[model samples]
Structures are given as C-alpha cells and as structure tokens.
Target: MCRWLAYTGNPIHLEAVLFRAKHSLIDQSLHSRLGHTTTNGDGFGIGWYGHPTDIPFRYRCIQPAWSDRNLREAARAIRAPLFVAHVRAATGTPSQETNCHPFRYGRWLFAHNGLVRDYPAVRRDLMLAIAPELFPLIEGSTDSEVMFYLALTFGLERAPVAALERMVGFIEETGRKHGVGEPLNMTVCATDGEQIVAVRYSSEGQSRSLFHSTSFRHLRDLYPDDPRILAAGQNAFLVLSEPLVDLPGWWEAIPESTAVVARGGEIEQYPFTPELA
Candidate 1:
C-alpha cells in the first residue's frame, strides 16, 4: 500500500537516498513500480536519529513529497547514521499528520507497509488486546500504529521478534474469529537505535516487496573508479520497498515470510512465521 526505505551504516546527506537514487522514495510516492498502488501520495514522513540519543528529529506532512519544497531543502541538510523514510497510500485511513509513519516511542522507531484487512471490523478487538499501559501511546487510528503499540505492550524493547510474532499472531487470530482470512500482510521495520530488524510476511504467504542493498564495501569496490562511492560510510546498508538502482549486484530480494536483521556489520535472514498457539 506504500513505499519506504531504511538506511544504516552511512552518515551521508539525506538527499543521496531520498532524491539522488534512480528510483528514490520521493519518485515512488508519485510513481511506484512495486507497490500495489502506483501512487503513494496520501502522506509522507522521514525520521532520523541525531547525535543525542534522547530525541530524534521527524518531519511529517499530509502533502505529497514531490509537492513540498521545504522538505526538499531539509533533505539536503539533515544527515544521520540511521534513518527511515516512508511514503504512504491510505487504506481508507484519514490523511492526517498523526497517521504518518515512523512512529516513535522512547529511542525506538517503527514503520509498516501493509494492511490488516478489514481493520475496522477487528479494530476494537485489537485495541483491547493491547495492555492498558501502552494503549494511550497510540495517537493515530491506522492499523500500522496499532501494530506498533501492540509490539510495545507485548515487550518490543525486551524482545523484538517475539513481540512482533505476538502481534501478528494476535491479529490473525482476532481476524479469523470474525471470519477474516489472511488478514495480515506485514513488511515492518523496527529499531531501538542499537539494532534494526525488518520482517516480510503475510498469512497468505505472498507479502509486500522488499529488498536490501549490497554491502557498501562491495559496491565501493565494484565502482572503485567512482569517487562518489567513497562518500558512503563503512557499514552503510539500505532496506527498501523497491530497488533504488538497477545495479545487478547491488540488491537482493528479501524472501517471502522472512525476518532480516542488520546490525554490527552483519546482515542475516531467517524464515518468519507467527505461532499464535
């Protein structure tokens, strides 16, 4: 339903990924090749962690990314070692700033690209599933935000994969109780500034599009003759809804129903399935 990209390992200008890429996130907002909908113009958001760990600078708008000049100017200036950029396509959700993605809680940031099929039908049940302590943290009425808080309620900070598994498990169980089948199509990214974990999964086994860029050192060596390659940092990694470039060895598709962890110069993938039982 939307397009997004997560970058780690580099401390380069935001424009390099948001604008300079051949198929940048901004371009995807106006013309997406992989998203279910070609246009994700409902809204946009970008979140980056600055030098201080206590806070992150975020800019979100209910306007199209291409139509905002101030965002373009800001993109050129802001830089971060880790960041997430998202372009949303509303799934019957209202177009509001609170609904924009990259939802934050403490040092954590999260975003999603999928639907909870007939979310309204199960919204109450899902809301009740969250612990009272975290129920107030939800500011938006989108399933994406619900998923975030559910993870928090279930202990995202203590255990990410397990918390997300519980979230998906609960959603699937609750949806099926209402005669909804395969109600989960989740391609989610969650981070606490120490580790970044991304998952691609759906109850139907066919999930959203996601790809990870080749290692920075590998790309730099391949394009050793290009000086621009040197601008990237040592651990630079990119996880996107679609390939940013057409380089043959520059990208790889994240397998269906898999969880990818990018941390400490290592990228690993594992088969992902939620066990509600």
Candidate 2:
C-alpha cells in the first residue's frame, strides 16, 4: 500500500500540506497510521501545475520522502493551486524513481494507493490492451502506472470517470480469466488541471482508505485561531488516503466503490462500478 494526497484550491506552498499538517503526507511516509504498511519509504513523487502553464511539474526520487532534503527544499520553494504527492511502499514492484506514484501524461496526473491483486497473472493481458500510442509512454513496471495508461486507453481525456470504470472492469475481467478471485484493490486519484476525480474501489468489495476534507468553513470554525485554516477560500479541498489531522468533522471517508469529483471548490460524488469494456 501507499500514501497520497491531492490538494486543489487557492494557491499555497506545498509545505502546508506536505509537511506542516499534524499528520501530513511526509509524516505518513514515516508512520502511516491508516495504511496497510506502517512505513512508505520505497520512493516518492510530486506533481503540480504552475501559473500560465497547464502542464504539471513532476519530481520523483528513489529516496524516502522523509529523508530527502531535495523534497523538503522543493516543497518549501514551490507553490501551486493544485498538486498530488505520493509516498510509495512497493507492492512487489522495483523501488525505482519511475515506479513512484503521481504518474503524468500530458496535463493529466494520477496516483494510486492500493494494488492489483495477483498482477503477474494479468500483466501481459493488461499491457496488450493499452493503445499502441500510449504503450510506449509507460515508463515503469508498476500496476499503478499501467492502470493510468489503461484509463487513458479507454479515453480518460474525454471521460475520466467512465474511462476508469472501464479500466477497472478490464482489470477485473482479466484477473478472473486468470483464476484470481479478487483482482483490484485501489484508491485512485486523477486530474486534468481543471477537475479532480478520486475513486475508492476493489474487486472483492473491500478497498483501501480514502478521505476528503469537509467544507473550509467548518474547518475554520474548528480552528478559529489558525490563520492558515481561516485564510483558505470556501472552495479549498483536499483528498487523501488518510486524514491529515485528527479534527473531527474535518474529513469524510469516501464510501467503497464511489467516485468523488471536485472542481472550483464544488464537490460531488457518484457511485462507481466496473463497466464491461
């Protein structure tokens, strides 16, 4: 399993979410309280967009998120209105920079917090399903990256949610054919610089953890003296594999097999299920 977080709203330094929170992503990298693994030190990556540029900037390393000085410096220096950061725990994949999460393609960014059960059984079939144009773009050997490309192959750019549904469906179907009972286990987040879509799903109806922040106004009321909490616009939102803080009413767990969409501070959730491709 892994830990990841996605932030969208008013511009803010990455440190505010990456390092400053009570149990930030960096903290989760060292001591994950909700993940299957306690430590997620295999590798890490961050993807964010800057002003005047729709394409995101991505930085990934084979070093642990908590021990990387470069990541600290970058987090302190860069400010973005939207970003996704991940700390990997290597689910039978190589601990290389390319295997890190927050994989990117064009203006899209994706991160996953779970695994494809018995991936080896379905790897070949899954790879062969990716569009020829997208197959060459896969730079790593992780199921997470393959899932990203699979979603793209199914038209992620045109229909993010539907594409992911079909991708998951394909994965499950492929696994079933190979005799794997439970094929998928994932909490995935993807964005196109305009809207964010996050899903928590699994083939056996048991998924990894995923949470999204409640309205900023509620957070402000909970932390009246915290300037950072008060300064956030009403539209500010965060989605992650775990709650960043222990504050009650500040986070809501995404239901199993559900997709949450956030755009311009407005958030909506829909039931998600695999669709035959």
* Residue ranges of candidate 2 with Cα displaced over 4 Å: none
| RMSD after Cα superposition, model 1 | 1.3
Tell how far residue 258 is off in model 2, in angstroms.
Answer: 0.4
- Give each prediction's root-mean-square deviation over alpha carbons: 1.3, 1.1
Q: lDDT by residue for model 2 over 110-178, one digit each (tens)?
A: 999888888887899999999998899999999999999999999999989999999999999999999
Identify the leading candidate in terms of lDDT: 2
lDDT of 1 by residue, 1-277 (tens): 8999888765778988899888888999988998899999988999888753646678999998889898899999997888899999999899999999889988888999999999999999999988897888889899999999888888888978888888899999999999997889989999876668899999999999999877878888787775545776657778999988787788989999888888866888887878672
User: Cα deviation of 219 in candidate 2 (Å)?
Assistant: 2.5
- Among the numbered candidates, top TM-score falls to 2
